[model samples]
Structure formats: structure tokens, C-alpha cells
Target: MRVVILCGGESSERDVSLASGRSVAGALLDRGHEVVLVDPAAAVPVLAGPLRPGDAIDGFAVGKEPPSPAARQQLRRRMHAALTGGPVLELLREAELVFLALHGGWGEDGHVQALLEMAGVRFTGAGSAACAAAWHKGRAQAVLGATGVPVAERVLWGPTANGVPEAVRRLLTAGPVVVKPVADGSSVSVHYVDSLPQLTQLAAEMRSGEVELMVEPFLSGREFTVAVVGDQVLPVVEIELTTSVFDYTSKYQPGAVSEVCPAPVPDAFAARLQELALRAHHALGFGGDAYSRTDFRCDASGEPRCIEVNALPGLTATSLLPRAATGADWSYPELIQRLMDLSTR
Candidate 1:
């Protein structure tokens, strides 16, 4: 099958995206498929590498810069041009399927899915609405909470709202709260506050924008991630961060953390976590043939609380999803092929 793996974006996860693209492309090539790796942030360029029976083509570089008004506009222009231009659109027309590996912002938040839908292109992962719902932590939490899924008690704080005082009250009641940006990913602007005084100071230091914030009681338990492919759950991977919490730096940097695949949890608890992960995925309208990584916090009672779901998780060699897949006896190349086949189906 001729596949196009879209990766790299203007989000803070650009580096992560590139790593994912490389791994995916290599895997596809190893599986005897024609592959094109494109960076949606840059202009589509001709991809060339040694051609073999299972060799993949890494093409296209989409330009991306730091998150800024000007940078966003530039990225939009580039995407519009790429999708409407000769090489990218032509490739889409010829390719059998698209393997979307892009992370954060427009990539993971449904913008790219909408574009692919408009172009009548079949791509991997959840559709636009699901992507949008999952990308916004507050909205996803609302949906999960309504369904009786255990989530951290959270209050949304806006820039111009008097919610701060009420939020402080909640923090006082639920000490050790985590403050996170509602729309951001990769833990950008996520901070742990041990007290109301620290929360107040942190809120004051936060940039005044229309961006919403979420204050939730910090769960004191182990952090585990469940990777789901189709209806099958790979394995639970425990994330051990060197820092106080798993922030952006700890996420991408190698050796900053260690992931124990299968999570060293009991079989019953692991099964429960997998069940909840599938529930969270389907509840968010991600029932299609795609992959997602659901995070959880297991308390002393051995119950897991859903944290957040990554619709498009990192595919780096050491990424949680791939790590779990590897533990399931699926090599990197085999995993990529499985993803491609699933997308096409």
C-alpha cells in the first residue's frame, strides 16, 4: 500500500512528531509498503531514499515555528497551499491511506482530520469531533465525568473570570491541586500546587489570555498509560518521572523517565485499566480503527482514574504506546504496518 505519514506541526510537540514520523516511515518500509513522510508545517518536497522492495519514501517538510499569531497564520497558509498544491494533493490522490502521526494543536485537535475528510482521504485515528473533544481537557473531562468515569475533581479558570476565588476555595478543600491549561498538550503550563498560597502565586504569574485553566486535585498514586488499538489493549505502561511530575521536558527527553511495560500491576487491575481506557476512547467517539493512549492514576484502592487521552500519541522508539506494543510482541515495524492496515480497513 502507498501510505503518507503526516507528522510535525507548529505545536510544542514538533520534535516529538518528527521522531514519530521517522519511526513510522522506517516501519512501513520494513513491511514492504510505499511510504511518504510529510511534515504538514513545511512545503511538500520530493522525498527520495534508496528504493527497495520494502523501502519507504520520506517526503515533504511542512514549515513550523514557535506558537505565535504570526506563526499560526504562516502555518495555515502553508497547510492550505500543501493540501491544494500539486505534490501533496496528488500524493493524497494516489496514496492508499494516510497515517496521521501529527501531535498537538491543529494536528491532533481535528483540524487535519477535517481537511482529510474534505479531500475524501482516508486517514488513521479518530475523526474531527473526537479529536476536538479529547484535545480540550475540560470538555473531555465533562464527557467522562457524566459517564461515571473517575476523573480528578476539576474547576475551569478563565483569564477574566471571578472563578479564581471559588477555585481557591476548591483548592483549599482539595489540597495539592494540579493547574493545567485546558487547551494545551504535552503538559505545557501544567504546575503542581501544594497549597492555596502557591496556587494564587502561580495564577498571578500565568499569562493573561483567553486561555482557560483547570485546577484538579492531584492524585496520589501511580501513573499508568494504556494503549488501545482497535478493541485490543496492548499493555499498561507505568511512567516513572524523575521530576515531581511528568512535564514536557520529562516526556520527550530520554532517560528523564523510565517506562515499565505491563506496569507491574496485577492482572485484575490491569484488565480494569484496559477496560476503562476502551470506555474512555469510545465515549469520546474514537471507535474507529485507530490508536489512542489513555492515562490513569491508580489510587491505594487499586482503582484507576482516567486522566487524559492522547488521540495521537507519540511514536518515538521509547514512547509509551510503542513500548506497550513492543511488550505485546509487536515490533516497531510490525506496529506501524498494523496501524497502516487498520487505517485502510
Candidate 2:
């Protein structure tokens, strides 16, 4: 099979996407598939041949300042030319499938999937509507709650004046709260506010964006995540971060957080967690052939309350999906193959 692994999008998750792409490419190659690793931002001139291991290309650098408008336009033209204007299009046209290893923004939020769908290309992961719903924390929570899934009590802080203070009051009424942007992942902008003063300070500091903030009661318990692929739930993973909370650093930094696979919870509790995760996934309109991850926090009483559902979960080497898949005895290649197969069906 020929596979095009799309990675390194113009998102905060670009670095993580590159790491995931490297792993996905390696796994696909190991399975005897021809792979083309494309970083859309770094579209370069015609290559002598397909990129080989350690091959370098110019016009792009990850985690750096993005190119100016004109530079970006040129890069886009080159990428479109390379992928759709010449032999590169022919090459991609021959691909058996496109494995989207990109995260955040247009990649994970359904924009790219819509483009590929219009091109009649079969790709992996959820559709645009599901992606959009799940990516927005407040919206997804409402959908999940309607399906009887237990989500944390939350109030959304929209762009209107008085929204922030109202949300803060509601959350503080319940106790310490976690405030985060409504449409963010990787725990970015997530903060724990223990009092009204802290909440007000954080809210004031976060007032510059159109992105709404979400204020929810902090769940005091063990943090766990469940990965679902085509209705099958992988083992639950418990996250134990060295920091007080699992922020962005804890997520991407190796060893910053410890993941206990097949979490030490009882079988019944684990089963319940998987059930809730699947419910949340389906409630968000994720049908068969899509993969999703649902995060939860189990109180001391063993009741697991849903946090959020990642429609497009992180696929980097250290990501939870792969770790859960590994616990299920599925190698990286097998997992990737399975995901592709599921998506194309």
C-alpha cells in the first residue's frame, strides 16, 4: 500500500505532529508500505525522488516564527504545485490512503478532512461536524451530557461582557475551578483557580481573545483517559503528572507525566470508564471508523466524571492512544494499519 502521511500543520501542535508523522512513517514503512511524508508548510522544489530517511528540505522550520503573508503564499503555491500540479499529484493520486497525523487547527478540526473528502480521498479520523463539535469544549460537553454521560459542571464565558464574571461565580460556587479556552487542546491555557481572587486575576489576564473561556469545577480525583477505535475501547490510561496539573509541558515533555496503562482501577471501574467514553464519542456523532479519546477524573468514590473528548487525539510516540494500543498488544504499525482500515471502511 502507498500512504501519504500529512503532518506539521500551521498549528501550535506542529512540533508534535512532526514527531507523530515520523513514527507513522516508520511504522508504515515497516509494514512494507511506500510512504510519502509531507509537511505542508515546507513544500519545496521537485525532489530527485521520494524523501529518504534523514532527507532535508528548505523553506520551513518548525516551532519558529511563521513566514510573512507573501512568503506563506509562495509556500502554499509551491505545496499545491508539488502535490496537485505535477508528478507529485500523480504520486498522491496513487496513494491507497491519506493518514492525517496532524493535530489542532484545520488539521484536526475538520477543515482538512473536508478538503480531502471533496477531492474524493479516503482519510482517517472523524468528519468535519464531529471534529468541530468535539474540539469546542463547551459544545461537546453539552452533547455528551444529553446522552447521559457525566461531565463536569461548566459555565461558558462568551465574548459578551459579564460572561466571565458570571461563569467565575458559578464555578467558584462549586469550589476550585479549571478555566480554559473553549476550543483548545493539549491542555493549553488550562488553569486551576482556587478562589474568586485567582479566578478574577486569570480571567482578566485572558480577556484579549475572541475565543471563549470555560469555567468548570475542578474534579478532585485520578485522571484517566480512554481511547476508542471503531467502537472498541482500548485500556484506560491513568495520568500522573509531576506538576500539580497536566498542562502542555506535561503533555509533550517526555517523562513529565507518568501514564499507568490498564489503570490500577478495578475491572468494573475501567469498564465503566470505557462505557462513558464510548457514550461520549457516539453522543458527539462519532460513528464507526473514527477514533476518539475521552478524558475523565475519578473521584475517591470511584465515580468517573467526563472532562473532555479529543476527537483527534495526539498520535505522537508518547501519546495516550498508542500507549493504550500497545497495552492491547497492537504494535504501532498494526495500530496505524487498523486505523487506516477503519477509516476507509
Badly placed stretches (over 4 Å) of model 2 are: 43-94
**TM-score for each prediction?**
0.89, 0.86
lDDT measured at residue 38 in model 1 versus the true structure, 0 to 100: 76
lDDT of 2 by residue, 1-345 (tens): 767878766566667777788778777766777678777656543222254445443322233232333564555555455544465555556678878887876677777777677667777888888888888888888888888999877888876666346656866886778888887677877898887777777777776556588888777778999999998999999998666567877887777789999899889888899889888889888889899999998665667788888877877778899999998999988998888888767
lDDT of 1 at 223: 90
Output the lDDT of residue 236, model 1.
Answer: 87
Q: Best candidate per lDDT, number?
A: 1
Clashes of 2: 0
lDDT of 1 by residue, 95-116 (tens): 7888888888788899889988
Candidate 2 lDDT trough over 10 residues, lowest sum: 57-66
Count of backbone clashes, every candidate in sequence:
5, 0
Worst 10 residues of 1 by lDDT: 57-66
Give the lDDT of residue 305 in candidate 1.
81
